[model samples]
Target: METPNRQGRRRIVVGITGASGAIYGIRLLRLLRGLDVESHLVMSRSAHLTLNCETELRPADIHALADVVHANGDIGAAIASGSFHADGMIIAPCSIKTLSEIASGVTSSLMSRAADVMLKERRRLVLMVRETPLHAGHLRSMATVTDIGAIVYPPVPAFYARPASLEDMVDYSLGRVLDLFGLEASLAGRWSGVAAKRNPGDAAHVA
Candidate 1:
């Protein structure tokens, strides 16, 4: 796939909700910046708390990474409108509450509202769901969103990439998510299964 074309710049709406993997959202912004993608960021109130709890970076730092920052309560933001020509939207570390809101189309905040716009416009929407041990209700919500063309992607690490650190794992997962939008990031290394298989000393060859 090729990068989206919009006035010679790829525009992506990024959302960060109250999920455990706050770093995913942060790394995603950094990667987008490196790729020269125009990013519109929106973060939930709970996301701020989660960011505070998980990382040392402040809200100012996050806001600086994006081309534009929309307040969570600002449902009137451009991204909340379907007419906005955005390539796609990605919610990294998508909280279950946020996911439920998006699935139900009861978006109370800009984050979910923007996500709803993506669906209504038939644009790509990727949710890096961060919950575990989900109940049936959570599963149902994921299925509903999937049926509506949203990709409910859990940030499952790719062991095939042989990630050496937490940063590597996070970048690889975000890179794969960006792949859904055709946005390439240098952080993720492509999987060379054939090359690994050809190496006699490789772990896969041993098995």
Candidate 2:
């Protein structure tokens, strides 16, 4: 059975790596704050560099969104243990290096350690791998993690949602991942029946 935190709130460990899409992690944290979930965040050193390059927010600004912030090097953190009693973990914009470390069961940082704990405890673990032009090595790593019960989620945008902005796209993806943990968020746009759009020279075909 799943356990909530001491305050009767679900706990989720969020990890951000050095991937190009840092906004995914940042927006996820914000979404958690509006829900009844406590977020424990740990970001790799490279994540800070990427965040700086991608946005104007400082590290402190990003850290403030989380309920608890852990150092990546702190392997002995609470979330690193199976007894920490977290609902699950989500590595937003997970980097290839982080994915490889988790897949190999050779966790070097607290983020990966926490992920390992989630797997051992039979808890939900989502890795939003952000990479393109993946080679065979990357595919193999993803398969290995999947075999061990970790969900390999790539944050691919869904144009079917008709997102008006980039934030809409990111929120929808993360919200769907949150659904795996049974935490519902309003950020994700629900898909209904397909709506067709026609142009001046186009004809609609009904089946």
Candidate 3:
């Protein structure tokens, strides 16, 4: 379907790279579908390998979740242009390789190109970098991106939410990331700060 290009409905560019948490990108798309937002998706080749190993969904199934899917090599895609008018871009499970490319302004793939566009345009760029034991180079790249006004959001589980299952954790992360766009996903666990005032036997679940 053609995008409406209508006012009020925001558009977000979603990029999935070769990282451990492809679920973050997938869940983000699912959440976007429920909100008044349009998602344009792009995935690196390594992302496909990771998705196959980490998720049950097939490529087509994954592509179906987004309003538009741009090829990773398609640097000429609409999202590559600053005039595309997207609200922002999110790179959930952003790989170190992709991060480096964007930090260096290499634009090796559509993911990096779109992210570069977002940064140059002074648009919101949130990256859920998925890595552990970050080294000096990783730290430097993160700082570089941050210097350029990109949000280096690592998808750490919020144990304070008292999640019941894996989905709950994933949804909570997605909701919080969506918040960066100033879009609210009500599924996220909110802290009321008055939990102790509740009944001793209360099993208050975060919504």
Estimate candidate 2's alpha-carbon lDDT, on a 0 to 1 scale: 0.92
For 59-159, candidate 2 gives per-residue lDDT tens digits of 99999999999999998888888888988999998999999999999999998999999999999999999999999999999999999989999999888
Which portions of model 3 show Cα errors greater than 4 Å? 1-4, 194-207
| Model 3 poorest 10 in a row by lDDT | 1-10
Kindly provide the TM-score of model 1 when superposed on the true structure, using C-alpha atoms: 0.90
Q: What are the per-model C-alpha RMSD values against the true structure? A: 4.1, 3.1, 6.1
lDDT of each: 0.88, 0.92, 0.88
Model 3, residue 38: displacement in angstroms? 1.0
Model 3 residue 136 distance off true place after TM-score fit, in angstroms: 0.5
- Which is the better candidate, 1 or 2, if ranked by TM-score? 2
The Cα error of candidate 3 at residue 181, in Å, is 1.0
Q: Assess every candidate by TM-score.
A: 0.90, 0.92, 0.90
For 67-183, candidate 3 gives per-residue lDDT tens digits of 999999897999999889888899989999999998999877889999999999888999999999999999999999999889999988898898899999888888888877778
Cand. 3 Cα-lDDT: 0.88
At residue 197, give the lDDT of candidate 1. Answer: 37
Deviation in Å, model 2, residue 183 alpha carbon: 1.4
